[model samples]
Target: MIESPGILYSIGAFLLVIGPLVFVHEMGHYLVARWFGTKVEKFSIGFGREIAGWTDKRGTRWKIGWMPLGGYVQFAGDLNAASQPDPNAGDASAEERAALFQFKPVGQRFLIILAGPMINFLFAIILFMGIFATYGQAQNAPVVSAIMEGSVADQAGFELGDEISAVDGRAIDRFDELADIVRLRPGQQMQFDILRDGRELSITAVTADVTVEDRFGNEARIGRLGVQSAVLEMETLGALQLPGAALTQTLSSLEMITVGLGQIISGRRSIEELGGPLRIAQFSGQTASLGLYAFLFFMAAISINLGFINLLPIPMLDGGHLVFYAAEAIRRRPIKPEAQEWAFRMGLAVLLSFMLMVTVIDLGSFGLWERLSGLIS
Candidate 1:
């Protein structure tokens, strides 16, 4: 079992992992806005009161805020960090109009908002590229070495030394790929293509729904086939192959994330499984203690998640702004300021409520509720 390194260590590790990522995300917006000749009023790395700050030569206030949850880049014509367009944006002087974000073309505005999430995906790819280039990629052949008695695989007629060629017509080259497909598909019937004694055969099975606990005592419900593969192989990647490998890995990670989110939305996964900032800190601390490679891998995974979450089409998010721009492009007119304001308010409410729910879940996962009940009793 893995033990947490205490609260202080977790907080420090969370900041170290999240700070650079937040900077990278905001930088994408800052650079893209500058490229479009828009004036950035502030580039803060966190929210709430500023802990420290300085003005750049270009008149941008670069500051670090007390709250390290997230950051924002506020443009000159923005009402706030959420980038709600100012109602009086058109009242700017002739010179100021050129530097205001609200005055930019709809296409430019879409791209500026898109850049933040896109850069995050790009950053994850770069990190994966470095990792693959340095340590190579490990692959476990999808050949079964053992099967549990009366398990799903055994009940499905799986035999020792049987090679899994495909699942549900999707080709599988690695054991982990098969595991991923199964994990996300609890209680679903799946067709497995098998190569046994040089003959191709098909078998079907209903995956077993199993609840497993991580070393840190977090429990997750997933599909299990009750098969094992011990034959491991490492493929050395060269400079020419790094990009392709990295892109493939990134896409695979994205697929897993999307599937997990789909499960949660479909009620196949519990909402209590959702984690917030506190859980992130716990993971950051745990991964940091594992080693540099472990920490970097966790960072890359979180970066992709951050990018994906921001692209969700909810108001007050980058995707929401892109949606507005799309409407403006089609209608040849901007969305009404009043309508956008109401949408932002609704979005803020939804976002905060979601945060609170996840925070409560995090506290419960830490046994806070159990301890409180004990005290009261």
Candidate 2:
């Protein structure tokens, strides 16, 4: 059973993960709208009550909210549900009512909508780079520490303390090469050349099948030869290595997101794997158990997920708004007010349903219901 996380760490983790992501996302809209001469009504992080706020020079209300789930930037003339439609929008008859969001040009609206997700992507990239700057890449060098008896190496008659000199007759300069060579070819026989006590010994070993479960609970059939390599020598980044590390980290995350999407579509993953708020809290607690660095790493991963998910072209999302903007640009007109309102309603329903479904999965995944069932039974 998973233990509950420390309250302070859990709260800190939530703030760390959500705050910057929302800030960047909202800032994207705020900056773009400003550039286009659009008046932003308010910039808010979270919902419900306001915690801290100030009217900016532009008269935009900058606020931190009590609820930390997500945020929004309300542009003037945003008389609709931000992206929804309202025929009565920005119509000032009797008193003071300047242009709200609806009055913005198609080009300006395009940039405003695009800004939110772009900022998220940029934030992820920066985080990845920051992580890399702190921890340099793993440098692989072959070092044999110990071998388990009755394992693959043992069955193959390979001796302990044998330095892997080559794999499949290929010369191995570094220890890391063995992992990919082994992992990619499951249930296949492989040749190994090891430096056993300074004597070259060649042997054949059959790779084993391993099941890998990712954070999303998607399992993969992987190849394993049951060989353990000594941990790579830790690295300390010099001045020149920081930028490279960050770039690599960001690219790696993007690749991972691609792989995840493909797997979901290919029937290799379950839709139940999608996680909502519950899972974030679960991960927060789990990471807190591993200490500060681990928690921060988890925070980075969640930030990336938030960024990517927001970019999906779903209605009620930043991406969805961008889609509408594109349509408006092509048609040279706003989507009809009624059409936009109906679209918002549809989008809202779909998003809410998805959230509810994922929350159920999250609760079950965490075993909270399981524990309760056991207690009841």
Q: Output the number of the lDDT-best candidate.
A: 1
- Tell me the whole-model lDDT of each prediction, alpha carbons only: 0.91, 0.72
lDDT (tens digit, per residue) of candidate 1 on 68-155: 9999999999999999988888888989999999999889889999999999999999998888777667788999999999899988
Clash pairs detected, candidate 2? 76-100, 76-101, 77-100, 77-101, 77-102, 78-101, 129-246
| TM-score of every candidate | 0.96, 0.74
Local lDDT at 21 for model 1: 93
Segments in model 2 whose C-alpha atoms lie over 4 Å from true places: 1-4, 89-100, 141-230, 238-241, 375-377
After superposing candidate 1 on the true structure, give the runs of residues whose Cα lies further than 4 Å from its correct spot.
none
